[model samples]
Target: MKLVKEVIARFPADAAILDPFSGTATTTLTAAERGNSALSFDINPFLIWLGNVKCRSYSVEHLACIQDDARLAIGRVPSLIKNDNWVPPLFNIERWWSAGTLQVLAALRAGLVEVFGEPTEDRTDGLAWVAFCRLVIETSAAAFNHVSMSFSSETTHHEVEHVTYLYLAILDAVLASGSAQLQGTGEVVEVDARAIPKMGRRFSLVVTSPPYPNRISYIRELRPYMYWMKFLKEAREAGEMDWKAIGGTWGIATSRLNEWGPNSKVLPEILTDTVGRIAESGGKNAPLMATYVHKYFYDMHLHLSSLPNVLEPGAELHYIVGNSSFFGNMVDTPAILAASMQMLGYSNTVSKIIRKRNCNKALFEYDVSASWPG
Candidate 1:
């Protein structure tokens, strides 16, 4: 948030800000609160719903009524999961939550559907749903502090109090935060980053943190929320979305391994060298890793190439990215992105290491800053 403020300070108060990969809407919310017109896009439907809810204007009284309705509905509904009932297939529920806990969750889920109906673009149902999602994690056996989803060694149990009161409390907090007076207009859309040029609006600034080249599967991480919200119905749908995402590991098939090919001519030499070395290492997963790395940079090349069409002359761009090491080969993502931006005719390109991560010696986050020629 501080970085976004610092970068936005360089432009006029009315300057438009764009975040292509607006993960949780941090950049969009920051820009809107500062009285700047902001636009955000994400391919993930769940993320888009989250971002839209965060950006929307909500009434405290209306939200309070919704909270009351939810509480009442939860009391009336019974805890029941039939054999034909739908549940997220990401993991076994018994492993993560006690039977009693799942029963309460099922009741809450049914109550939410009965009370709130499906989420629509016009109402606060999306906010209510997000609050439920929060409750899921807070009451589950998963370690909430970890960066990734991790189940406790022992199953965690929850009482009715945990589901009812906790959800109401979380909903109240969400309402309190959403009641803030927004200074500027914020718009969020579901679209691919490469399709920005088609919007036909030149932005004055761009602030985004794209998915790192690491093997982390964001789609997998979001599976629970997506499934619960009905954004994704099956594993095949999840794999399709992951395949279109910028950085993905689990969805790439072996037959399509050769499709990623070599590095693009516009990228830095280090990227090509790193990919070549990884492919030649003869490790079990080396080829897959190499393809993933190559596909990431290649996708970025296509995305950066289109930025000029939607950026105002002299507009600034700040990309928060991280370097990664796969199979002991370093992928200097920031440097390669800087090179790609320069190749796309962006001038005054610069890459700076913002902070070093403790998890890996080779991992370092960077800010790749550049300007479109006026």
Candidate 2:
């Protein structure tokens, strides 16, 4: 948040801040706090919902009502889960919930749905769900070392009061902290960064920290949340989500090649370069490496294309980027992306490398890099 504020300070007060790939709407919210009109979009539906509703202004009365609703949902949790008629047939009914705990969550979810519907009713609903989502992780049976959603049967933790109280506390804190006031009026759209052009909007500043090419697969890392939202199951049933995608870790660094074919030439070049390197690697992990490169370049292309439409001429875009060595190969994504943006009709001369953190990279001392629109 502090870094975002510092970078934002360089722009004007009424700057239309935009984050084309707003993972969790960090920049979007920051813009709102500074009284700037903020717009953001993400490929993840859950994230879109989270950012959109959380950033909207809310009333104290509305928050209080949601709090009461949450309590009521908690009260009816156990019974709601046990009622066979309400359970989704495809889910493992027997293991879906830990009897009482599942009931609580289900009831809470049902109550929210009853009041506001699942997609989120208001800012308060967003706050409640955020709190609930965090609780789900902490109280879940998933392993600590593995961020994946594999539960451990040997672990036994009671989820009744603890989880409920945790959710309430978080919701209270989010509301009390004046997040709603800070957020103002903002919208979170569920769309790929590549699809930004279709939205046809422009901004004063575009601030975002896109996923580094060598970092974790974002989509895969978010499987648990996807599963919770039942999107995984829906996609699996519809043949949209399959083993290949799962194995690829939810299309983080890999996407269907055809998706990028229509885009600018930048993606194709990056993909070709990355694929050549992976082939040179020549190992079983070759496939994973190829996917990473493909996804990275494709996303970069899509992201850059959207900015031209959404940004005013010479309006600055600050990207927090990092360079990393993957499989002992240096992928100069920062320079490449900046150059790509330049090629796409944006100037790329005015930028700086502000170090926020660092890693053991002999060539570069910092993990953070800053850029301004050319």
Candidate 3:
């Protein structure tokens, strides 16, 4: 958030901000709070919903009513869980949550749908839904500190008192955090970043953090939430969404591996060399990693090429990206992306290393800042 604010401060007071990969809408919310109109885009429906919920205006009366509705929903949980129709996708209820806990969650889900109705584009019910999602995670047996969702060996007892107390606390926090004045108008679009140019809208500033080229799949991390929210009804649907994401690895098919060729003219030589080394490693997963790295740059190339259409002359772009190490080979993602931007006619393209972390040695995060030629 500090970094977002710093970048936004560099632009003029009335500069329009665009975040093409607005993960949790942090960039959009920051821009709005600073009195700048902002537009955010994310391909994931759940993320888009979350972004909208964070940016939307809500009344204290509506929030209080939601709390009351949640309390009533908790009372009806036992009966709601008996239907057996609310099972999560690709999951056995007993594996992740206690049977009693799952029942309470099922009831909560049903109650939210009944009280809030289906989520609309305006997302009037989004706050209630987000609160419900928070309850689902906080009450579950999954270890919150872990990178992936894994059930803890020790069981968690979730009685009515515990569940309702936690739910209400979370509800209050969400409301309080969102109570600030939303100074600027904001919009979140569910679309691919590559297609932004086609929208034919121009912005003075673009701030985003694209997915790193690491093999970690965000789809896997988001599966539980997506299933609970009904954004994905089955495992196959989850896979489809993963395939559409920028740097996805979990659901990529073997046939699509060859679609992105071995070399990219726009990317830096360091990236090409890393892909070559990974491909030559001869490990079972080597080819897959190679293809993923190649495709990452290819997609960025297309995204950079299209930026000129939507960015005003002299528009500034700040991309927060990270480097990755796969099979002991480094892929300098920000450097490669900066190189691609320069190739696409962006001026003053430079990558500044912002922070370094000791992740399996050293991993660096960078701010790849550039400008469209005026």
- Residue 233's lDDT in candidate 2: 56
lDDT for each candidate structure: 0.79, 0.60, 0.77
Residue 372 alpha-carbon offset, candidate 1, angstroms: 0.9
Query: What number of clashing residue pairs does each candidate have, in the order they appear?
Result: 0, 5, 0
List the lowest-lDDT window of 10 residues for candidate 2: 238-247
* Residue pair clashes in candidate 2: 77-103, 202-310, 203-310, 347-374, 348-374
What's the CA RMSD for each of the models?
A: 2.3, 4.5, 2.3
Best by lDDT: 1
Among all windows of 10 consecutive residues in model 1, the one with the lowest summed lDDT is 77-86
| Candidate 1 residue lDDT tens string, 1-374 | 77888998777879999998989999999888888999988888888888888987667677678777877767765544444445566557677667777777777777787788866566665777888888877776776432466778887777777678888888888877888878887878987886455667879899999999886878867777787788888778877788778886545433355675644465767678888988887777887778888888888888887777778888888999998887677788988888888777888988888888756476788899999985
Clashing residue pairs for model 1: none
Tell me which of candidates 2 and 3 scores higher on TM-score.
Answer: 3
Residues 99-190, candidate 3: write the lDDT tens digits: 77776677677766776775556657577678778888787777743245567885576886677678778888887877777778677888
